[model samples]
Target: MSAAASSPASPAALTSSSRLAWLDALRGIGALAVVAEHMLPWFVPSLRPYWFSLGVYGIFVFFLVSGYIIPASLERHGDVRAFWISRFFRLYPLYLAIIVLVLALAWWVPVREAVVRDGSAVAAHATMLLDVVGIGGVADTMWTLSYEMVFYLVVTALFLTRGHERSGTWAIVFAVAAVLVGLVASGAVFGGGWPAYVSCAVFVLGLTGVVLGRLRTVSACLLGVMAVACLLLSSRVPWLGAAVLAVMFAGTAIYRWERGTGPLWPVAVTAALVVVAPVWAIESGWWWVRADVWLTTIALAAATFAGGMALRGRRLPRVLVWFGLISYSLYLVHHPLLKYFVQVSGDLRQAALPYQLLMTAVALAVIIGASALTYRFVEKPMQDLGRRVSRRCRGGLQGGGEARVPGEDAGDDRVLGHQERQVPHGVGDHVGQGDTVG
Candidate 1:
């Protein structure tokens, strides 16, 4: 029987196949775009005007993919304990590894100390709620992880409330709210001492909700409140943060429509709103507006997602698939690698164009190689351990009986094995699955 048959809550059966090659390819492409967005400006300043903020495009694509895949994962499992277990194993190992490496490197590099000073670093490490608490990330790239965590909480709320199918409607609501708030709000909604306290409270309450799965409805409502509050009130850029969430839900809406779980109109409306929201949210005469970068980024992200949908069943290149496999590691490790490289090598903007390009290429190669090792040694092993632990936990919960939904275990063992081993791919929330980078 397939893992899903044996454990009906496991989405691994759906996610592990080669059928999702297009999504994997999109992840690989996004990973490259993010790396370029960060590395290019340093090496080719002149090109910065045109390619500035390409990271925005990369992250938008990441968020969309995350929105599409993560909810499916949660709903498939239909068990909060299993879902959280998968996520913890998928995300934390590599994340903790990177943080430790960054801190250790900081000890030797003066420039790195900025990440460790004050209580901010400790808070970030302790909670992973740093950005929501109005404290900066230990590494600049970590800000996205905070948003990813909130997305997970919000998804959990929807799941518990049995309202996940209405994701498209939520997308529209968030987008509209973002526009209105952008126009009227002069500053952050909770820009005071309350942010940290509120963040901590939400974190504690969210954990409690997960643990007390019997009170799912109440837990869901509480999580929803916390998530919405954090997004609207505590974010450094509430409008953009809300817009990002909308875009992610828009992706989720699209997935629901494709899977026959939702109406198409919401998806259509959400796509339209998301395309315009970022542009609308920006203040007039901002650099992004002046350069028309916002429009370009949105357009590129939309096109990429659409193309992936179009080519959903086709096989992608092995290299691209490999890139997707290690994309999360790439996202996590690349920024610090670039930071340290630039710090050690000094500014290379004054160098010849060829030399700058050469250095950029070298930096990318190193990051990729390092990512491969980490994926093999860290990500894969930890995920396997998570799977085993989840199996044990499920067995215990069910009094040693097979924990499965009815009638899902008739599949052939070979097919089940293939399905079970498929790695869930995406970026935005879970660094390995759909998490963020710098």
Candidate 2:
């Protein structure tokens, strides 16, 4: 399909309902940033400032986007079962394939051990419990997945209790409130260890923005400012709360006063953050910029939000859209692919830069190819099967006059459910397919 053709189905088609292009673009950018972060060692001896900024900031954008998109989709469908079904069908097949590939590569690669840590990271990653215990996956990057799952569970529980609208609202309220309370409770000033809470809150924040996005220009900006403010307060900022308030206040001013909303402002702001984050981090001299580093990530998250705002309802090229689609697969497997490639390429004593760059490019190309293959032959087929099974199971439930049990209808479709929409290829009632950066 042409790039334009691949832009998600238009919002006009859905009438008042619109597709969020910013989120898709942000997702694409986030995934690409992650891949690029992995590839950074090859190009620069000391990591570039921009690369560092993108690395930390990129994940926040992923979290924010995920917060907005997943619940929004669930609300769109309204059927809890269908929502879960869609999520699973979309994420699992490709995830499973990656897990298998990672396992296979374990025997041949040494760096893979560093990424996975041991068989446990793989096991933890496989279970999607990486964040709960904080061990993460072999990929190291999959830590976000753990944070994401906790939010999903929160959403799922709420959905089960109340329908999407009420539950989503409550989820947001509770999440925001919980974040505020957690900040107070932590007594760390900037809310230490609140990434877990921020994970859930940001998703709520994105959801809140989605709920209020189209109401009016003011409302959109207000909500966006609120989200940014919450994030600022949640992290370890240099000036702490004051800086957060200043940025949000300034952002609000832009929204209120700035006329002529073209893509440039957002693009500029986003680009600025993208460039500045790494430089600032290097300057600060923080080693890894742990959970305390959320201050740094805010700009990328905001840039993504701005990008999402700009792209709303407009289509980009199809190929870019597909990249967004298979991003999860690409993300899950990119670590292993790069690790193996780097290890093998180490033997080439030629100019390390050219050799590494060439290999990185080749690895990325292979990842894309593998992702496409997985999407076509694995994800799509399983998703189809899942939908069919869900329909059949739903029909059976209605016919038999009984409620459905979680795994009662277990089938290939379990891998493709709507709520199963994001990446955990393993362990969940249902998983979502879209957000893969974690």
In terms of TM-score, which candidate is strongest?
Answer: 1
**Per-model root-mean-square deviation over C-alphas:** 7.2, 12.8
Model 2 RMSD in Å is 12.8
Where is model 1 more than 4 Å wrong at Cα? Answer: 1-16, 49-52, 110-121, 192-194, 212-216, 278-281, 289-291, 395-438
Alpha-carbon lDDT, every model:
0.64, 0.45
Per-residue lDDT of 1-438 in model 2, one digit per residue for the tens? 342343344332432222433344555676777676655544333343432345655555565556545554444444445544555566556666766766676667533332434454444444353444334355555555654554444444444444323322333333343344333433223432343343444444543433333222233234344333433343223222222222322332232222222112333343333223333333445543333344445655576666765666666666655566666766676766666665666532235566656665677788788767866788768878767755554432111111222222333222122222233221111112221222
TM-score of each: 0.83, 0.58
- Candidate 2's C-alpha runs over 4 A off are 1-22, 43-47, 50-52, 110-126, 163-296, 347-356, 394-438
lDDT of 1 by residue, 25-97 (tens): 7778778777776676666655554533567777877788888877766655556666667677878888899
> In angstroms, how far off is 395's CA in candidate 1?
4.6
